[model samples]
Target: MRNLVILGAGTAGTMMANHLISKLPKKEWKITIVDQYETHYYQPGFLFLPFDIYTTKQVKKKGSKFIPKDVRYIQEKIELIEPEKNVVQLEKSGELAYDILIVATGTKIAPEEIDGMAGPEWYKSIFDFYTYEGAKALRNKLREWEGGKLVVHITEMPIKCPVAPLEFAFLADSYFKNKGMRDKVDITYVTPLGGAFTKPKATKALHHLLEEKGIKEVTDFNIERVDYENKKIIDYADIEIEYDLLVTVPTNIGDALIERSGMGDDLNFVPTDKATLQTKDYENIFAIGDATNLPASKAGSVAHFEAEILEENILRYIKGEPLKAEFDGHANCFIETGGGKALLIDFNYNHEPVEGTFPFPGIGPLNLLKESRMNHMGKMAFRWIYWNMLIKGISIPFVSAKMSEKGKHLEETV
Candidate 1:
């Protein structure tokens, strides 16, 4: 049997596993998935954890449980990926060779990249909500902790769930308001980008919300280091922003094995064909999700969309056929605003987020770029869809892998 080895058991990896198991001939292919993690986290739930909207039990499930029985699942640390020899060396298990390899070992936050970020203040005042432990810690910190200058910051971009920090800012605004401490606390949003978000229209709408909510906005601030002693963050321009508590999204990088293999870029993300999702140099290797240096948002929806295209391409590859499907960098995100409302944005590589009804034109149950209670409910309902449909390799009803222009209202340029 030809070996098809997959790295990582995260969302993208798991979905790919389930998809291939159903497509590939059982007699011709033997699939095995490797991951060091035992538990699979619903990462989006991390955003809610700090706000006490989700409990620890709600965010975690066994990684192996989601994996299909037909495929072999190994829990172990990957030491290196020798792509030249089609070998994967594990710390404990012996080296495994594969005919085809899928690199889905997603990005990780490297807080130490910034000076003094992982110092004594870590987990105390300097916190991150990206990891399970950090989110839980921040949850505790937010509780019984009187209001002060709370700064929601991002060290750099290409982080998973790009809208999460903004969501945190909006949620914090509402949280403090509910606690009657809105007057007692001061909030600031710090980012390296020149605007509130990557897209212009979304940024304008979100920036308006931040201003209306009285949350201070500091953009284009390239973080230099965390001043632990002074409780401040200094930027490259030598400007200092003081804070009582810092909830930061640290610099995101790919898995160390990618760097060790010499197959990745400076940030360790594997260099991939922007349209095909195939590694540029290695024809036998394919990359999906945040593992590849795709210029798309490293969000679950992007990964989910990529999986469909990847599944088709892998099948074509095995049959000695050309890859027909192409990934468009499509991304869908829900931006939660304060007080039981949220906004949804859908776009692809070419299209910026536009204001129009989604799924159904002119008459959408969910509005785009505008806040609505229905959108908030849709956001909350996604957790259920993620668990039941997404990771299980099931397609979402009425949602296509490609971004649709049917409902979007494109702005005319002169």
Candidate 2:
């Protein structure tokens, strides 16, 4: 029997486990998934944690609980991935050979990459909301402390849930307002990008919301270092931004296992085919989620879309068939605009997010590029959907892997 091994048990790896369990014939193949973490986190919930919108218990569960019992689940660190021999060396367990390898070890925050960011000030005055611990710490800091300068900054792009920093800024606006201390706090959003978002149309819409909420914007600020002693962040251009509380999304990079395997790029993201999800260097190896250097947004929605395409492609590869080139970089995101309202945006590699209806053509119960209460309800409802449907590999109704352009208002200005 041939073995199929998967790395990491995060959103992507766990879903692949659930997808392949029923597909591969039991007599023909065996599946195994490895991750250092036993606890699986609903990473998206990390955004709401600092604002006290979600409790600690709501975001995590045992990684084993979501993985199929039929699949071999190893809760151990992956020491190395020797692609040349198709073998994976575990920290304690001996080497495991595989006929095919799926690398889904997702990206993570690297605060150390920035000078002084992860130094003495980390988890004290300066914090990150990307991790469970960081979010919880920031939550406590926000509770008793009277607000001062709350700077929501993004160190670089390709971070998980790209819009989360913006959501934090918006939510901070709402949080302080609710505390009746809106006048006491100052909120600023600083990013390396030229605008609030990546896509042009969405940026225009989102920038307006930033203004509406009175959150000051700072764009194209490439941070050189954080002056923790002076309570300020210094950019390469000599621009300085002072802050009492700094909520920053540090640089994001893929797992070091990819680097150890010599199968990754500079950032350790596996070089993968943009359409097929196959590693460019290895025919039998595949990659999914933030681990791959795909131009797509590194969000769970993109992973869910890729999983559908990959499941089919893997079956083709098994039968010695040419892999299908079908993934289109489709991504859907919910942007919280504060005050019980949110906006949704959908797009693919070739298209920017525009005003549109989602799932149905002009009949969506949700609106795109416009803030509404229904969109928020959809965002809140997604937490439940993620656990029950997304990670379980159950297909979400009304959402397709490939993007549809039927009802999008793409006829106007780009």
Clashing pairs in 2: none
Count clashing pairs, candidate 1: 0
**Per-model TM values vs. the true structure:** 0.98, 0.99
lDDT of 2 at 293: 94
TM-score of 2: 0.99
In the range 54-127, model 1's lDDT, one tens digit per residue, is: 99999999888899999999999999999889999998998999999999999999999999999999999999
Residue 149, candidate 2: C-alpha displacement in angstroms: 0.7
Instruction: Report lDDT per candidate.
Output: 0.93, 0.93
Predicted candidate 2 versus true structure: per-residue lDDT over 1-414, tens digit per residue: 999999989999999999999999999999999998889999999999988999999999988999998999998999999888999999999899999999999998899998999999899999999999999999999998797898999998878888999999999999999999999999999999999998888889989999999999999999999999999999999999999999999999999888887888888999999999999998999999999999999999999999999999999999999999999999999988789999999988888888889889999988888899999999999999999999999999989999888889763324
